[model samples]
Target chain A: MIERRIQSGVGPKTGHKNEKGVGCLNIIVCIKQVPSTSNVEVDPVTGVLRRDGIKSKMNPYDLFALEQAFLLREQYGGTVAALSMGPNQAMDVLYEALYMGADSAVLASDRRFAGADVLATSYTLAQCVRKMGKYDLIVCGKQTTDGDTGQVGPEMAEWLEIPHACNAISIESFSEGAFTVKVNMDHSIYTLKIEAPCLITVDKDVNTPRLPSYLRRKRAGNAQISVWSMDDLADQAESHYGLSGSPTQVERIFPPEAHDDRECFKGSGEELADRLYSLLRQKKRI
Target chain B: MAHIEVNQKKVTPEIAERLSSVCPFGALVVGEKGLSIESGCRLCGLCLKADKDGVLTLVKDEPTVEVVKSSSRGIAVLAECMGNQVHPITLELLGKALEMAAPTGQPVFVVVIGWKVSSAVESLRCYGADKIYVYDDRSLEHFEPLRYASCVEDFVRKVRPSVVMAGATSMGRSVAPRIAARFRTGITADCTGLALREDGDLVQTRPAFGGNIMAQIVTPRTRPQLCTVRYRVFDAAQKREGPTSQVEVMEEPDGLEKAGACILEVLAKPKEPDISEAEVIVAVGRGVKDEAGLHLVRKLADILGAQLACTRPMVENGWFDPRRQIGLSGRTVKPKLIITIGVSGAVQFAAGMDKSEFIISINNDPEASIFNISHLGLVGDLYEVLPAFIEKVGREEPVR
Candidate 1:
């Protein structure tokens, strides 16, 4: 049996300095471009995804993150700079962010950054964030629809040596260089006050993201979007940006097997209900 | 490091076209000098496998850093405690770890970290762990990511385990990547399959691209390969009678009390058991339409003593709690009986509950994909079928 010891006065303290010391908040919202449709199919013979006419769109979850940033900036008098790391085509999402009220945009486009796993992807994003300059908050979507790995935001926080919180359902308040956020952890919800220079990944439906304004798009004609590659970043090592920097390797990729043998019954609602109820009784599943 | 090397002698125009078309990411380019691999090459080796005449081969180079393969040993599982009882997923992972460790003769260890978790630690003894590490402290009651991750880091440094696994619960997903980043190793999330290679490498298989494809990942050059497995993906370890296991109480690490974020309040949701643990579930999707439609489904669930679950759209529409959502992005459940209403079975949604022992899906659309994986498919309106089903169940003998 182990003895239990109690500690006294172990709660959170106030009056921490706003690390950046900026009068207003400077936010960076990380966004991504994912395949517009989830029904991507693979060719049987070649075993490759048929990507001929698949359109791209901003990850739906990132829209909520962008809305959160825009809302924060509206209340707190700050600038929201949208950042994305992908091919040059990714700049379209950055421009969409601008039309959605972002002050500026930055795209980290480089051939060397391809084939990055979570670790390498986060490292490259962190390097890009550092190059973009001072920011009090970095917001990201809960996860990308394609990758569906919620690890990138936290891993980026780790690389920057800052604290991070995921599944943020709401941002309650901000004062004294700390933001009180309500995080949804499956079984419970926690309200935490984190100091500045931290990262957060917001959950879906946190807010109804505002649509891109046609007027704003016309006014922002020929808006310059900064593009940074390996040479522009602080870390120029080829091993740290792409596949070589990634620790995990994809051993195989194949289409998931589908269940083909199934029974189907089509009839009126009353007939189907009776059939299902009787089937349930026969199977002992009631 | 490794790369794709294209042989010039064997490359004809026809072969070059085939090779270029074989790469999924469009990494192979039929350039003026023949086929060349570009930066988009993911080292997936598909082109090499497609090359019948040896036009392409993967070349490996000596690693820059020496891999100390002998320093690490054993598999460690991070056991989670919910209100003094060990979470079932922890036992599932331990069972998996034991199976993987049997071939290598590696020891199995379980790490429990929380406040006053002695009961949880003791409960794990019967699960067949060789040793248990406990970090029970008052300040560690509510999960602070920094503190929890620090404790895990200390354990990893001390034990030097070759592999670490945790459940893909909220807490596990939050802390696992941070620990992996601390060790600068690879961490796979939401892995549905895990196996150990003869060389002791852990291979993780997970669905990607919205469950359209499955990817097998491995950490070739990292130690303590980390992964988070979803609940019900593996069987729980059976408790042994009169089990003998060494219990080691870990000392609190330095600065354990100082966390970057301070918890202001912790609100435990009402005592609804997790959907994954339910024996019977009635799941709804966008086809349920309005609040009135949802009410009828709920009534059916109540009649059958089944829990309520939903697809991703229902959660996004704010019709149900995110916890109840089932898909690749949400929880994975393998209940004994699952009944889906007005659900178009997308691959992502099917990935979560297709393993249920009995599945019955009702949709108005005759061609909905939900019918493919379902054992009993009913093509009818949910609003009409739900009430009729409720009436039939109510008129019959009470559900057992």
Candidate 2:
């Protein structure tokens, strides 16, 4: 749990400001490993994705969150910790984060954490954050490519009983233990000031993520990564860890029917263009 | 505990092999117990369909939450306010909620949370809501997820509605989960379809894995089952002849002033119309290789007076704003005419614009999947085709 150390002279109406001072921000970035390719196929007869040797990589969206964390750390002297919750292989993303300049890495891996939906997954990560001790801010990608649900970050904030902002495009500045963030809300953009000890999920294209530095990788060789299981968490109840903790369940899964009824036209470009023009006019779609 | 029960007598070597192969997560194995379920099983229910001889069954322990089951009633729609007016998606959700409530005779409630939202609440009156709950205050002018969620939570706690829904907009996506988390209930995001069972359970159907498959989700054990649907998935509620809903002014919830985030300023995007509202769209994809290729497509769009859109890759490639992206993660558009150039029509992209009245696809590859969903498929290179199309459209009379 984070300590909300209210500093003197900062009025209560202005929101809580940590006593850690301005330049010593402690940030935790949550990352995930997703299937490298989006073109995963499902077997026709069995109705299951063919998962026989699919490679995995850090989620493309997470790179934005990591880059945001790095930018904050660069501007304000602070430590950026990269955290992930997945199988043992998920450490690859943590190492990738380390190579990209994260000060430390942690992984929450347990067999009991399998089959976790968004609720359970966020609960588990929140528990891990609690066990990790004090921190000012938590960062996450807008959503995962596989799940496509942008709820985990806010849900985690709920479990931590902290405030959260989503779809953040940029962190404009930090002062008095609060950060001003610009969020892209599709039709409009909001510039908001969120106090420290909160969570923010960054949208994609926030910044150009830096490539893993070879020198940094060499310097951080064999850097220890803390791995935590369910036993290591403050919440030890089995019911709140994985499948049991998840309130929503996948009742059924089926392939989307492909529409195949189409009129194919084969001709020269000019002919096709003329054909399309006339068809559009005839169909009143021009 | 929920577990898969495999009937050993019905399991043969061939059956075991088939079940094991059908298990996407490799949670099935042919072992000394004949056929066993492992920990990796996600309860996706694919193996049950694969088992021809009834060899598998999913055993779920009944939830013991009778109190919640008995208390929850009606369906509530969180009518999101855009600026001072109600968002169109809120009307769409009201339409859906009213439809779901008709058969069960359950009342449909609308919650409007915003400052100076009387006009918005007044406009919602003719939408057939049984009651419109308004949480109007000066501090609620800008959307703070926690404050907005607190207002909605107060209504939910008091009414104990069986289901609560909101639009899948940025505000909805941010606030719905927080509300759901507060109640410790399930929340499904970007649901494409919603249905209510006789037992009052909300069935939320949504696409997953980049629109590769559709999954049906249910929150049987939780009250006020939460879900969000994207815009344009359902029709907006038509206003009735006269106002019918009873308006209840709600007091601002406690701690309203202590929101975690403060909106310093709101910058409304320049009036470039959203693609979801576009009548005609000219969409390009990965096949439009370079900026030169994009230039040709842009010319075509200009000639047609159509909005220019693109697939996810084109946006990721920095060729277009993310708002112009049409896919599962982006906007869902049902334009009157959508001309897809060099697009292979990945399911994720198709899921967005498939409902368009007319689809014309131009791709060099004859086997491109874009043709499958297109009304007219041209088997030619975009480089050769776009120029001719542009020339013809420019010379012709304005269609719009």
Q: Using TM-score as the measure, which candidate wins?
A: 2
CA shift of B261, model 1, Å: 1.3
Interface RMSD (Å), every candidate: 4.7, 4.3
For model 2, residues B1-400, the per-residue Cα lDDT tens digits are 5567888988899999888887665568789879887655666677887778999987765654543575788899998887677889999999999999989888899999988888888889999999998899988888888888888888887888999999888989998988877777899998878999878889998877553667788987777799998888887899999999999998887778876688899999888758999988999999999988989988878767799999998887788998899987788998889999999887678778887888999999996768878989999988888788777876876534
The local lDDT score (0 to 100) that residue B292 gets in candidate 2 is 88
- Model 2 whole-model lDDT (C-alpha atoms): 0.83
The TM-score of candidate 2 is 0.89
lDDT of 1 by residue, A1-286 (tens): 0111112112222122445543478899999988776665555566766545456899999999999998998887888999998777788999999999898999987767766888888888988888888787899999998777788898887777677899899988778788899999867899999877788999988899999999889877777889998899988877776677788888887765656676889999899989888888787666
Assess every candidate by TM-score: 0.87, 0.89
Candidate 2 positional error at B137, Å: 1.1
What is candidate 2's lDDT per residue for A1-286, written digit by digit as tens?
A: 1223221111133223457547767889999988676565565566766555456899989999999999998898788999998877788999999999999999988767766788788888988888777787899999988777788999888777778899998998888878899998857899999887889999887689999999999988978899998899887876776677778888877666555666989889898998888887797666
Q: Judged by DockQ cut-offs, is candidate 1 incorrect, acceptable, medium or high?
A: acceptable
